[model samples]
Target chain A: MGSAPHAAAPLLEFHDLTVAYGGKPVLWNVDLTIAEPCLFGVIGPNGAGKSSLLKAALGLVPIVAGSVRFLGLPLDQVRGRIGYVPQRETVDWDFPVNVMDVVLMGTYGRLGWFRRPGRQDRDFARECLDRVGLADLAGRQIGRLSGGQQQRVFLARALAQRAEIYLLDEPMAGVDVRSQEQIFRVLAELEAGGSLVVVVHHDLRTAAEWFDRVALVDRRLVAAGPTAAVLTPENLRRTYAGQLDVLDEIGRAVAARGRTP
Target chain B: MTAPWLSAMTAPNTLVAAGGVAAVGFAAGVVGSLALLRKRPLVGDAAAHATLAGVAGGFLATGRRDLPTLLAGAFVAALAALGVLVLIRRFTRTRDDAATGIVIGVSFGLGIALVSGLPRWGLAGSGGLEQFLLGHAAAITGRDAAVLAGVSLAAVLVVAAAVKEITLVAFDAAFAAAGGWPVDWIDALVAALVAAMVVAGLPAVGAVLVTALVVIPPVAARLWTDRVAAMLMLAGLFGLVAAVVGTLVSATRPGLATGPLVVLSAATIFAVSLVVVPRRRQEGS
Candidate 1:
């Protein structure tokens, strides 16, 4: 009952993806396709490997099996075409760096290493910060920022990448309403720019209204299509009320809510 | 001739040793700040105790009472201990704290065993090796102080050249890796810097707890500043003050050890700073 994807080939594809932590598998036998420039959402319970899927795509986490492609090409060949913003909580805030310095790091992939960040790099960083509404706070230390502000800084760094595809993991996890609105607006603008955007989001209410398409994932791909159809009552019941004692209740609720239909 | 205290401190050779110890403190503060910020404050703790085995090995290998030759052996042993710690981490299921504990306890045991066995083996200068535990800076020659200053200078230079990379990796390893920065190598480089500073500090703080020489000043300086570069400079200044004062105080108490005195002074500084300096306010920028 899903509408056909756009005629154009998928910009990103994951083929028979499987990932494990230690010895046991977390994500298993997953195949996914994203076509055209759209806001694609991945909704799942806490252990559903939504973040792992993104990590496997970026070569950030070890994948036991699977092949991820960008524009039907291997990741390494199209490395410049992608940008990733990992979880905000993943970094130490107490580090001795300001917001602008953190954002400038996003350009390092294109600029390469051992070379100092130049004036052009600063200009690009400034542009990205301004885009995130962080222009006035560029010189401030990141530790001094609120949780929401730190998330915006992470978004600013990703924006600095200037890639055609952006992968964001829980961009709204701890952000305040204003910062969340700021991030969502930026994401909406990216989608409008002919960029393929995928977010591993937990908020079902927002996901329903925000995403044009979403993939409902548990240990496996439970369902996927437009947000409304993917988030059917049956899918919600199976996702939240399913006999998954290993999963957290909040994760289940979030997964159930992220459904569009 | 000056006042009695000034004249006493003016002894030309003593002046040189004090000056050298001050530089050692400066390098320790700089390197220690990096370690502390990286949350690896006690890594030097492992290197510090392991130097005892090296000191004994140095005397046994060269059959010399010369401080440099002994310290050279201690340096090699300390690096080797660090190597062993890495191997343990890679090859075993033991936790890092456990591994650090093993290196600390066993190497120190080996050092004590070797030193105590010296009398039975009729080895010359075995008795004097005990000075390396607490330090005998008074016994260190004018030339030795100059050597210490040279090593300290090299450490400062390394910190200056690699500040950007070191700061990046220390703050966020994953971000550094994502940026295609050599995160692991940068981390290893900082570890190497820490080792160099620990080795340089041995003649001043000695093997038993020279790690404190690196650790204490940075702890003191953290209370006073938020910026990393400023913290480094302040920590170095604190270390220099501690070293000079401790050396002077030890001179007055003839039999007192210089290393412990220096460390105690640094501890006093740390306590005062922690008490006096208010925690910086958090402002979400």
Candidate 2:
């Protein structure tokens, strides 16, 4: 909850991080750090472990080596101050929960187990719903909403969490143009409010325009820093065209056998 | 109402049994709603099928045919089956559906073998072990009904207390885990509650078909509502109605197995709901 000590330590830091699936490494040793609140993007080719970076940082997946620290502390000690929005496709949209119900989940982490959300929580959820331009659809079934609206609902849920940092995975993958703009605007507002917003995005064109800082990853850290500095043609080629053959072959072999490569 | 119908409804023993079955039905629907939302309805089927083995083992180990002892054994077996399912999923490349099928087929087969062998083995007082195969509510005494009702009530309370957490985990496990909620533990809790309801239902619905008591009502209720809370309430109501109807109908017919009657009644309600509810939702939307 406290600000980074003396503003010297990075707000979020990943050191020598490695991740594997079924004992086969997918993400190799990588190191990265974010020192302040900004619109940060993790951009990579498909299957380049972009999503896995977020998952490993949030502890959704195993970290084979190294550590992720938030404000110089372990994730467990600072989880409540962190909000996460997983990929839109990670959940079943047909689940029997309304828009409000899904958004209310953002409050569950802070409310802890067995404690119901109170009037203030409901009001806050409504406020978040309004932020995503879906306040009127609060009672609608999630499945009935369009893809853009569904993605916004997830954003609203993360907003209700009221965290100091946010990690969003593929929030704009299937989103329409207008919804994409709207999502970016809300994320910009979050950053304006002095919260760190880290987005795992796929579109390179949008990444160039949207992010103040970006990290290009292809199984490992290719380049990172200011978007203009790190998103150069050379860095882009290394990230996209320079996919490691050994990693690719091992990944395919592991996937074919349903084991970790 | 007919005279016999009135008498059947008013009879003390029948009323007690009906009340107990109603509790089981309500709890099953409530717990099963979570399981259904989690997209693991068949997990209950595996647990239910495995309960037969436990019932037989309970009788053999405790040398008693009481509801508590048999159900205790049944619960243990149900958990064991779930554990096996988890192991198979974690250790093997077999898909979830195939693993579930393996557990269901193998455990149920072992159960049938044990129950069928009990009588031939000439174990004293093992004559009624086969009752658990298809279920006979007439065999449940008032004491047994009370115990069943107690377990059902407890299960319902557990669901109510943790509805928010359970729903979060079911809907988005990755988000829940990132938020520091113990997703695996919540899932296990839901599974355990389902196992409890399955065992509670064994006296009336039996191992082979008890899963119907848990699954059908929740699926039917889903057709009627978009909200989790409403779906849970409607599912419980639907389950209660089915349990009561099945119990009473089976009471009137002496030789009918309560399991089939209960399942048939639930399926009928599900059919009706499927026909009636979605149309209304479509019109409203």
Candidate 3:
């Protein structure tokens, strides 16, 4: 199903994708496709396998069934064309590396092994840092940065990858308002530049305002389409009400829909 | 600093011994730092402890205690221990800490039993085998030193070549895997290097505490630098200094073991760094 005959294949596609951990499925039969460039959101409540979807696509997690394709090719064939920003909590920030050292890792995929990043790579990394408003902090240790600054550093690293498809997992979580705005702006720019930016987001209000297309996922994908059509009250109820314990929080997210600016 | 020891340092054998131990220390530090960054510091410890059994097995199999033969056996033993660890993790319900503890206790105990029984069993040429328990650098031959130095140089060169790839996996394995880097192979390379260093360190630091050879310098270096390249260099330097100091100091005293002295010197470096390096950096968490 992922390999179509036409040249104009979808940018990214997850066909009958199922992700499992220890023999138990977390995400089941997710058939989501992004045909063009856009700011796409994977919105879900806590424990809804939102991150799992991205992990499956990146081959970080084992795909129990089905396959994920990027531009009609398997993940390995198109890995160089994709940039990934894992969650901030996924790594130890106290590692003995400065910001510039980390951002240079983005160029590693292209550089291959043994050859060190040279003058050109440094200049490009600095430009990436500049894009994320972190050029001055490039020499500082990653641990010394604020939460928002760290997230921005990660964004700069992803930008340094120079990829056409960017998959960011919870890039805005725990970030200050200014950092979130800057991140969204950079993602919007990527979309405008004919790149696809897929994000795993938790906030409903921002999902409606920021993403051109949003897929509400809860273990299985609930609804997916344009932002206005997919984020209806009925879909939100179905997505959020799966876990009866979080009903109050679900109601709050639903009630705040009108207040979305 | 003593007159007798300073004079002894001029002796060709003493110089060779010190040089070999120095290489082992430097390589251990370089390899150990990568394991430390990977958050598997104790993995080296497990391999270090297992080397004792290998030392015993090597001597028993070859009927000779040459540095290369014994270290070859030790390397095989260390790899076997790591392989067992992987099996446990893959097959059993045991936690990692518990598995590590199991490997250490069982391997170390077997080593002590074997070494102690060698003399009682009347095995020929087993008189000095007990020296391996806590290392005795005074007995190291020039040939042994050359072998140690050779292995150390090789380990260091391997790290120098792959430092970038190793650092990437250490920092963000998921990102590296996503980028199509062979993360498992990199991790395996690190493990194999650690085992080699542990085997090479068996003569100078011994099996009981050789883990310090790999662990202390990297940790101490971490306190002094925020850069990975600088950290690796500092770690190698610290390990070299500690190995040289321990070997030299043990030379001055007849019965003193080299392992404890080496560990103490590394501990001193760690202590000084803890006191001197500022803790003013913000906590990232």
Candidate 4:
């Protein structure tokens, strides 16, 4: 595995990771490695466990087996260096917090417990909102924003973390074209600034255009490499339609028997 | 001459009780905001109902009717109910709502049975324990009122200190967890705060309806503001008004329990906010 002489450990590594919900594995033993800072994408169809992959890595969900490492260390050791943008629908938009309040959450991890955000944090959060083109709407109630604007607010929040590695789950799923372009551009800039941005996206066409490297997933890792190499017609078929019934049956059996089927 | 009812409202003991109850109301609103935003409003209900068992058990075990001992018992019961709710949700296939309902119904029933049976069994001094069922604020002494006020103040301070952490967890738990915040511990702190508020409220609002003290004001405040800090302040103010007004009004009536009046007062504010605050614009045009 060290044959590539003196290659620094991947920016993130998932070695034989298996994630489950209620004893049912959603992501199978998946070995994925992000060797460098890039705009990476995890593309899959509905129910393909794309989001679960990120959840497992972040310790949001229980991983039945395997380990996740960030910068050659466990997640707990480098949590401050990572940022996460959860799906827009995962939260109640009507929650009584403004756009700035939500974005300021990005700085909470760095501030640690019982510490309020200082002026420096606020300025950085405002700069992040500016990057996402929502500076003018910083005081608006998050629920009052458009779907695209809400998505951008989440992006801005993630950017406020000032993280070296960003993981976004479905940031553009319901976003308008203009907001999608804005989000992609910011992500591209993050990559240029030497931060690894891993996005869980489903749109195939845009996946081809946006990601520098992509992983095709369907309950398991199908193909992973440069976007051009991983999104071939055969890989797409395998990701969207290949061995699904068989995989489902095996997953159920494995869950029932408490072992891989 | 002032009316007899008006004179009753200004009695020294009654005024002291009202002040303490007001503190409880404010604290409940603040802590309850986090629970409401976290979408765990019913957790307070479960904890509130379970407090009855603790109140009765405290008297039974210690043979003392001190406010602190009774409330300490109630806090224990509330935490136990929450623990049972978590266990049921985790170990069994019971849905979240169903689990909460089970804890509420069963624990409250147990509490009611114990409270009722204690007096019938001729347990001396157990007669007044039933006042905790619907709350009788007039029964509170000046020292007990002071204790309630002090605890309420501490709870509010705790919420103030951890406002950012609580708000982050409430708004987006997954993101908070990913950001390496101790999500479970934060959630547990919120729950414990809710339990504390519930216990603090029991002397004024009663076990059966105490959750209202924690829920109604924050919800009403939500209608009037879009910012969390503003909502919290508004909720606290609304709660204080409801508690003070309810206590004073109940003082006027000879046979009134304070819990229903406090809840009704809060509900009235919520109804007014519903009519007064403009509707928020729907997204996406």
Candidate 5:
């Protein structure tokens, strides 16, 4: 698959993508193309399928029926090329690990099973941590870091993957203003380096100011385009001001799926 | 190897008790770490109490209290409670809190009934069986405690082998999945570990409240440190302290049920953490 040597390929392509938690679909008809590298935002109200989109796109969540291609191939075909930074609260801060250890996980995908992370892997992790301004704190316990620093550690782990596409789920959620700026700066640098960065965000203010393009989602794709076009009053009202019947239905569907047949 | 001190004042019993209790502490620390880190530290309380019915039933059926055979019954009972919990979550409109409460209240009542009624049924050797409800560790023979110690030790070993994988999965399941770690299996392994510890702890803490060993230590340790490893080690130390102190305390006081005594020791540890430790920063700024 790697031998195709197509550098100009679209980074991500989604066709009629639908994702469900139990049997209830959370994301529907998610047709989009992330061709050129850009700072992208996925915005929606609480319980909207914004987080679902990022997870499904990255193959973290289950897809009901759809096609998601990365660089003209399937997820397994280009696993190493994709990086994911889940929510800041996804990990247990009390885990018996340091920043360096968590960052090393980014290299695990490439190293495969039964292979210990060697010096080269360590060096890449260190460099990634350094880039995220966490080099000095590598040896410190992960739980001790501030929220922003914790988020950066996740980013550093993603960077350690040396991936071409990054899917960050609410990296700025609950973060201080300086951390938000710092996180956005890293993404901007990553975008400038020709990497696709898709972020799931709840804050509309940050979405309006930071993203180059935004997808306004609530159970379905309401609108997706350049930030200015997607975050208009109409779209914002459609996302937050609506009854959220669709999301309620989706949540029920999700709950039903976990039941035994 | 058999402990060789039976000739002394307490014979091999005291050595076995000390060594076995220490192992239990270490195991509790390790097992409790995952539960505590998951932020569901006291989740097993209901299941732990429910195991009493199963323990009594096992003795009634096979007419034996051999540690292994008895534990098999408690394991089944614990799994049954977990299954019931899942059902409540699915079928009833009852929230997780109410469901947990129902299970905790009803199951323990059933267990208490079975324990209290066993002797009236004219069952042989049922007099001492009630101790499991409110433990009497002196009721546990050296062999029984050894078996308990061995099981806890084996569980600690399994946790050690899978340390990296469990830490990765617990800390961030999605990232672990993306990295090709089998997040599901890790979760199963953790459940298995917790269940096994619960079963093993029944002999010392008894089926009525073994979950305390699984929760209290990790919580006490949390107030002392931030890192996962330190928390785990400290939890183990705390559990050991609880187990040893509880056992010794019961040893001193006649008619004090070791189970309640043990849980009280852990409760004391938890109180110390709550009062002496710094308060947590509230979630919303």
Candidate 6:
């Protein structure tokens, strides 16, 4: 299935995707096609299956049905071309690994079995750390870092993967404003370098300002397109449903930004 | 054949037993560190307790009661117990701790019943099977030591080869899986290595407390360093010292089993590290 008839097939595609946990469906029929390299934001409320969508695409969660394709191929065929940074809270910060060791892990996928990361890989990892402004903290144990530093470290590791398509789950969650700006700067650079950057984000204020395109999701896709077109008041009301406070704030953020939502 | 230098030493049998137990200790520490890092240290305990039944099963099946035959059985039992653990977690609503407890209870009880009943049933060569419960390092022959050392070497080599992958999966399994790394296979490899080390540890540390060999040194080593490679090496060194010291001490004092001595030695190291190291201060920062 490596050969797709259409040369311009979407960079990433979720064909009628569904995800379930313990036999309960959390995400359903998420048919989204990201056709270009852009800063794509998956905006949703709590428990709206935003994380599940990314996890399902990564095959971390059980996909009850449907399929995910990268570059018109199944995951195994194009895995190395895609990089992922899971949620910051998904790992133990106190694990016996320093920042450099964690970043070096990003090279593991390319290194394959039994091959150690060499000097070139180390140099590249250091460069990735530098990109996230964490070059000096490379020797510090991960737990010693603040929450923002930890998030940046995760981002650096993903950057070390050096893939064409980047999927980051809640990269800005619990991060300080400064670190948030640094991460977004790096993501913007990634986009400028002609890479697809899909971020699972929660805050609509930044989602409105940052992402070029956004998908409104609440278990199912409400709408997806250029950020201004997709973050419409009706879509926000539909996706957030009972969460009126969030909708109101988001509406104000959109209007204040003057994005013609 | 034993090493030329080892054979030339006084009391060659004791030296062999010590050497073999040392290797087993080193391997256990290395393997146990991985298990501890994986946050499934108790899984080794479950595999350890399940080994006795395997020993009994081995003897009953082959009736030879040789080290190779019995250890082969113990290895199978350890894997089986681990398999049951995976099955329970996968198919049932039982929590991880409860499932581990169940495996430990059922397997250890079955082992005790089997070993206790063997001699009573008039089975030949079953008289010494109970020694496996608490270990009988004194009974280790040159051949047994060689087999133990061989198994230990293989287990250590596997760890060395996969240390990076193991550390990767342990630290952040979600990232590893998302990057398309075979997290499940790597986890299974670690479980299998733990089982192997647990089975190899049976002759020196015994089924009842062999988990200590695979646990205590790594834990103590953790107190000394925050690096995985350093922790692994220190744990291995600590295990070797404990095993050699315990075996040698037990040799000098008749009627004392080597298993308790080894565990005590390891515990002593752990206790000292606990009190002496500034781990709390570092943790606070």
* Candidate 4 A-chain TM-score: 0.94
Candidate number with the higher DockQ (1 or 5): 5
Between candidates 2 and 3, name the one with more favorable DockQ.
2
Interface DockQ of each model: 0.29, 0.67, 0.58, 0.69, 0.40, 0.61
**Candidate 5 chain A weakest lDDT stretch, 10 residues:** A252-261
Kept native contacts, as fractions per model, are 0.29, 0.88, 0.94, 0.90, 0.49, 0.78
Question: CA lDDT, every prediction?
Answer: 0.82, 0.91, 0.89, 0.90, 0.78, 0.90
Best by TM-score: 4
Candidate 2 residue pairs in clash (backbone atoms < 3 Å): A24-A261
True contacts kept of 1: 0.29
- Ranking under TM-score, best-scoring first? 4, 2, 3, 6, 1, 5
Cα error of candidate 3 at position B79, Å:
0.7
- TM-score of each prediction: 0.87, 0.95, 0.94, 0.96, 0.81, 0.93
RMSD of 1: 6.2
Tens digits of per-residue lDDT, candidate 1, B131-167, equal 7888877876788998889989999988987776777
- The 10-residue segment of model 4 chain B with minimum total lDDT is B276-285
| lDDT per residue as tens, model 2, A1-261 | 355455567789999898888768778778999999999999999988999999999998898788999888889888999989899999998887899999999999889879999999999999999999999999898988999999999999999999999999999999999999999999999999999999999999899999999999988898999999999988888888847774876566546655434
**TM-score (chain A only) of candidate 6:** 0.91
Query: What does candidate 3's lDDT look like per residue over A1-261, in tens digits?
Result: 524536688899999887767655577788999999999999999989999999999999998778988898888788999999999999999999989999999999999989999999999999999999999998998988989999999999999999999999999999999999999999999999999999999999888999999999988889999999999999999998856544444444434633575
Which pairs, if any, clash in model 6?
A: none
Clashes of 6: 0
* Native contact share for candidate 5: 0.49
Better of 5 and 6 by TM-score: 6
Rate residue A62 of model 3 by lDDT.
90
Better of 3 and 6 by TM-score: 3
The full ranking of all candidates by DockQ, starting with the best, is 4, 2, 6, 3, 5, 1
Compose the digit string of candidate 3's lDDT tens values, residues B158-219: 99999999999999999999999999899989999999998888887888889998999999
